[model samples]
Target: MSATVGSALAWWARTQPEQTAIVVDGESLDYQGYEAWSSRVAVHLRDAGIVPGDRVGLLAENSLPWSAMALGIIKAGAVLVPLNSRFKPAELRKVADDAGLARVIASDAVVAVAREAAGMGAPYEVTAFADVVGLRDAEPDPATDAFRVDREPTDPIAVLFTSGSTGRSKGVVLTNQSLLSIVFEASLTEEGFRQGSTSLLVLPLAFTPGLVWGVLMTTVLGGTIVIEKDLVPGRAVRLMEEHRVQAVFGVPLIFDAFSRTPEFAEADLSSLRTAIVGGAAVPVPLLEAYAAKGVTLRQIYGMTEAGGVATATLRHEAKDHPATCGYGSIFTELKIVDADGQEVGPDEEGEILIKGPGVTPGYWGDPETTAEVITADGWLRSGDIGRKDADGRIAFADRLKDLIITGGINVSPIEIERVLMGLDGVAEVSVIPAKDEKFGETPAAIITPSSPDLTAADVVAHCEQQLSDYKVPRYVVLREDPLPRLPSGKIAKPQIKQDYADVHVDFDKVR
Candidate 1:
């Protein structure tokens, strides 16, 4: 068995050296090329004084070299810290100070930014992007003989930073087993993912979903990972068509863009057989838009703590039960429990807890916080409120912290948002709690119109047809701009809540 990240890639290197491993920007690298290039990077890190258990930071735009650098760090027995590509100097400094990074490799555009962050307070080495990827077999390093893969499956291989939606961000520690085992077990059961499959990807590889799940999973099977240079709608479609990509993975927004692009209507998407759409609640209109093109959008649910993906809707099951994130994967087990910690019955709402091989041991260097989330019995508290049906299909409610209490009644903003999305002329909607004089708190929504004539009254009338009295959104704000989004591409709920926390809508206007 492959006990470490380097060994994981080494397994494929020995078995199928000539098989294409990654397809980046119209260029291809077979398993042999992957092994050679990654090994060269390992030698570079060794020359730079990296050691086992030391944290090395990666900061660069998503590209072939960026992925190889990550593997190189692992092969040299160092833990990788993937710095966010969108992070400014201050934000970058915080993580560098926290992780105590030994060195950071960055692109040309980011060299000054990374150096500025280090100049403020951090003392880590900031290596230019060229030095990391400039290696070749022309003049081999004598220190290459000293480099060895010595880490175990349980040892920390990476420290992934969360999206920081809930105040300060926490770094989630992951192991080789916590990551490699997920895709290994998944391919054994999922027909859509196998040794020869080809998947197109666009999300930044610095994040867990893009790197650990999408990149690592595809590479393990000797499959092709077609990395999109950018998220331009027309460009993504052209690459997918030319590469004959069989599967796709991204947040719902990326898929929605493809469906809306003028070229997508006539694009040769016959090669696409499966897709993963998550990172936020997917509206039915988004699903139907893809269905018309013979594609079924599978719902996926997971977090940074679970080592990337916990559950995914099968390609065949997405059509009938669109809301289901599907039963837990073979390596993961899901349970919904009430506040008292007792497991709830089918369809009974409660907090979601996960336990499995894919679960992380804990957050990096924060035992107190880790203990609060991970119970004594070993189940990891997901903090998401949801329910599982009798058949084991899971449906999300809302974040436990996001639940609104008005007149002592718990209100799920997600439920109301779903109903609002079903209404015509509503392009996008986010529901938040608005302070009410009489009720304490009432539901408020900010909506982007699908048509120019969409009105607050039109939204209220549609809610009346579907929701109960209290569930209806009392404050409806219509706008032409898109909702604010986090770096991970998920909607910025905290920003939304902050923008409308004290704003009140007149009862007469909404009526």
Candidate 2:
């Protein structure tokens, strides 16, 4: 069987040609309709001298055209570089140049940013939506039975750039086999396709979890996908009711917003079966709340380098193990190893390492850095600390780089954040290490309150009851807005640390 993503997409198109494949806003496109448009886009790309293995940068928000363009690029056998639309002009330019892009497909909203990046004469051609989809009212190309080049399982499909704690972004190179492995694994475990299953695409497709698993997985399984440009709570509720969406994937923050919407309570969300929550730790209370609504909230834990998802709490286990990150997927092999590379026993916390078909080959153009993380034996050091229970369920601890060392004790920030998030009036919280002369470092809590009446002292007192004396925040900083987040919906901890470091305080005075 061919393992290429294009092959899977083609198979779905052939089997369900007239079935609805994508619905965006009010527009709908069936498999045949989408395939025809994708073919025309591929022909245009081929005519422009783009060849197999060439990188094509796609800069757009969640829209129908972006999905069409992605499929078109894959059919043309080119690597798709889905640049984050939130990136600034300079950041976009750096990614385009680094990937050695031959062409870029920019949406109307991002055309100006694309132009600014292309002005540097980076040897790449740029095309806006008007140039491709709106040019000359072109007719869709027929599905030609021409000779096509076969793709290996290892052929590069996409390059996802993820931010590092050291203030640099690393490009994780995903292949067709790796991406397909994740899609297949998710399908097998999640019961993704019943009869008329519909999935809502709320997260940005530029991110790995969204683009690779969220969108592409639905396509491969011949399921309908509802794409939304913005994640307004009202719009999400209306779309769910309008389309009878059965499954959805989102981060914790998105879930919170959806739950708080008045429309959510009134709308007919009974069609929703499974809601996969990840990107950040899911508060225990949030998990229980969603479960009360007849939606099974599965906690997924993975990173870009691992393709999409490594572990996910199964629907059956969602109610009991709401805090557990769950077991590894079918194709994924996860182990907790100590610093010396010895595998730790069950229930022991250690660095998480994964080895499987779902793991990416390595980072793009960074052999040294890649070698540092991906061992010679093919294990990718996840940089995350976790422990596996006897039942094979994995529970997340903290990122190795983000672990707080204070008073000769290593504290997992995730633990503190989870506890703090349960406090009354707290909307969001992030724990970081602050400079402390006595303990070398102390845990500091940066909190954003849902109400104006919340004060730093109130939060400190709340933590004093639950957390150990030392684990509680030595310093508290209240913010009016939520913390900065990455495109993946994970908190930008590096930026948070920097922001908190700028605050000068007397540790002795607080004590």
Candidate 3:
């Protein structure tokens, strides 16, 4: 039988009618209750003249209503455009117009931003969650039973916009089957779900990792999800203790914050069986910190175009191999290809490419950009550089574009960042290429110190001992605060480059 998003929800509702499926803040919703609420939301959307193929925009934070709206949109056979809540009004307007949305459903916190975006003369209607649901309650849709399972597995479910290398954002199109393939594969793997398991949701749902891996995977596996308003380390620990959360998904930044919290030593985190960490390079020191707490930290590698997770460090191998991104998941096939697009041997670094059921068909409304990344033969060029060991474990190197070329020598920024992250005073670091007069480009380090006493000489001295001289940063810029971050939780390299472009100097001057 072909599986659809709506059918998956219906299956869970039948099997676990009374089981708690979602806990948003303090409110609980069992599978039966969730199904009913989703049906009502679907009825409301249809009444608002939303057709099966129509695009419905969701501008909200991570909440029960947000999840319900997503399910309802899919059940109604319409496409969901989840707007990034962090986007400014101008940015939001561009996305809404590009997606051709008919109506936007926004949360109370983000309603003003949505209103301003709507005021930009986009041909879309805006409504808040409170207003829509309140009206639905007063005159409950008798047409709630009108929902029909008309969508195919291949039907587009959601559109995710990602910032391009050139600064423009491209919309990635994800189909129901593509997302389900990931969930289904995860269920069949070693990290497969057990009934009644619980997962904590902290990542923003607008990001592919949060929407696909954090929420959809947990729900499909018959697991209960506990949603938090934001990822405050102290609050997250409390929620974990209160709900006995078994799985937690976070990025490196979240882990960094959690490691410093008193809860790292004081909280009872024995309920946590797996902690999936990704979005940036996971430092070995950070991995050891969590390992000491009896929590396994699995490094994952994924993107918006790949339905969230393409590779992850398996539970059994996580401790022994902290740096590896692990082997491919059940739904995908991974290949490391050289510059000529030919597959390379084991332990050889090259561009990581993926071909699988979880891969998206293409980007929305941009054939030129889509053709550049996805080939005609179906391989999705990840643009990330990596290598696979003899045992089939894949280790991440750096992004193809992020590689620093100094005196014609290529250096991986992630390689240097990982080493710097282990330094005594460094809290975070980003390495980028600085234009040079003689050499094409040279490496520059941007450091955020955990201790104020740390100096540029200290970072250079530490690197000189560990890395090659050419790979060592020529210039060091101290960041008094935490580095800027993209919505996906990774350090914003573009912003950092722009901020320090004028401070470039010779390595001898810093020495």
- Worst-scoring 10-residue span by lDDT in model 2: 140-149
**Stretches of candidate 1 above 4 Å error?**
136-148, 505-511
Candidate 3 per-residue lDDT, tens place, 1-511, comes to 2477676677787788898888888988787666666777777788778888888888998887788777777777788888888879998889987888888889999988988888897668877888655532343343463354457777787888875432557788888788778777766765534567788877787777667776677667767888877878888888888899888877888887888888777888888877888877777778888888888889988777887778889988887898888888876888899999998999999999988888889988888878999999999998889999998888888888888888888899888888788789998899888887777777788888989899988999989989998888877888788898877777888887778776564234374
Cα lDDT for residue 131, candidate 2: 74
| Residues 20-132, model 1: lDDT tens digits | 88877767787766777777887778788988888989898778777777887877788899988778999999999888898888888798888989888958888887776
Off by over 4 Å in 3: 135-149, 163-168, 505-509
All candidates' lDDT scores?
Answer: 0.81, 0.79, 0.80
Error of 2 at 452 (Å): 1.8
Clashes of each: 0, 0, 0
lDDT string, candidate 2, 1-511, tens digits = 3766566557767788889988888888887666666666777788888898999999998888877788777777788888888878888888987788888899989888888888875767888988777532455444442213346778887888885544678888988777777766766777364434688887788887568765677777777888877779888988988888888877899988888888877787788877888877777777777777777788888888887678789888887887787778777888999999998988999999988888889888889989999999999998889999988889888888888898889998888898888888888889888888798888888888888898777877888889898888888888888899877777888898887784436333243
Residue 265, candidate 2: C-alpha displacement in angstroms: 1.7
